[model samples]
Target: MVNFDDKRNFYRMLLNSEVKVTIIDDEINSEFVATCRDLSATGMAIEMSHPLEMGTRVKAKIESANASVQALDVKGKVVRIEEEATDLYLVGIAIDDMD
Candidate 1:
């Protein structure tokens, strides 16, 4: 038998944060504010306003409820999008250094 683990990082420290998402496209742009439920070096799961479909790419800022920084700016692709209740979206994004 083999152990099957899905998470890339389970032991890494996760901080609860509220982040802002800027979805940029050639013709359209949208802004969203969401609570970051979990975070890692590679990715984060955010509770957002609208459900970003899987593979949707966007720019994000990891701003906490307390402060803000320049290092939080990054591009991400939505790997999974989950909807809870109505008008709320749980989106899993894969962070990338390359823009």
Candidate 2:
């Protein structure tokens, strides 16, 4: 059998860490706690209790356990969402900018 590698441009890093997600809209700025499942240079997958609408702008932050390491902070938009279970959703975000 021929072996095939992932076709993604960037490699994904699997994670099970808490992520702070903030929805930034013209009228509302709500923050929520979610779990980051996987991350790549351009995108990330997160599991949250509620589903986010597609194209909703958001900011995500992940703090590092080590003091020496910097936290991951990025601004992105919701690109995909899937129902993983009742009251649970897997959301995919397309990273736009990083801080």
Candidate 3:
């Protein structure tokens, strides 16, 4: 028997907080709110009302409630999208640049 587990280098932190997402396409910019499900050093998972197209560029911001923890702001690309419900979608994004 073999044990299986997450293969990523960074462990994912479970987060149930609001995330602000900004889509960057050419000169058009659009913003929306989503719920962040998990976060890691390399990527994050978010749940939103609508699905984003694969390979779309976006910027995500997650503000920390605790003063000790710093807020996360990163530019990433949409890697995957899955429909969870009739109007709900789960989106995966790979972190490209962080601020």
Predictions in order: lDDT: 0.72, 0.93, 0.92
Superposed model 3: Cα runs more than 4 Å off: 1-4
Assess every candidate by TM-score: 0.72, 0.92, 0.90
The lDDT leader among the candidates is: 2
lDDT ranking, best first: 2, 3, 1
Count: clashes, candidate 2: 0
Model 3 over residues 1-99: C-alpha lDDT tens digits? 112386778888888999999999657689999999998899999999999999999999999999999999999999999999999999999998999
Which run of 10 residues does model 1 get worst, by summed lDDT? 1-10
lDDT, model 1? 0.72
Best TM-score goes to which candidate? 2
| Model 3 vs truth, CA RMSD | 3.1
Residue by residue across 1-99, what tens digits does model 1's lDDT show? 112364565433455676778776524777877888876678778886678767878787874344553447778888998788698888888888633
Task: In candidate 1, list every pair of residues with a backbone clash.
Answer: none
Question: Taking the tens digit of each residue's C-alpha lDDT, what string does model 2 give over 10-99?
Answer: 888889999999998646789989999999999999999999889999999999999999999999999999998999999999999999
User: How would the candidate models be sorted by TM-score, starting from the highest?
Assistant: 2, 3, 1
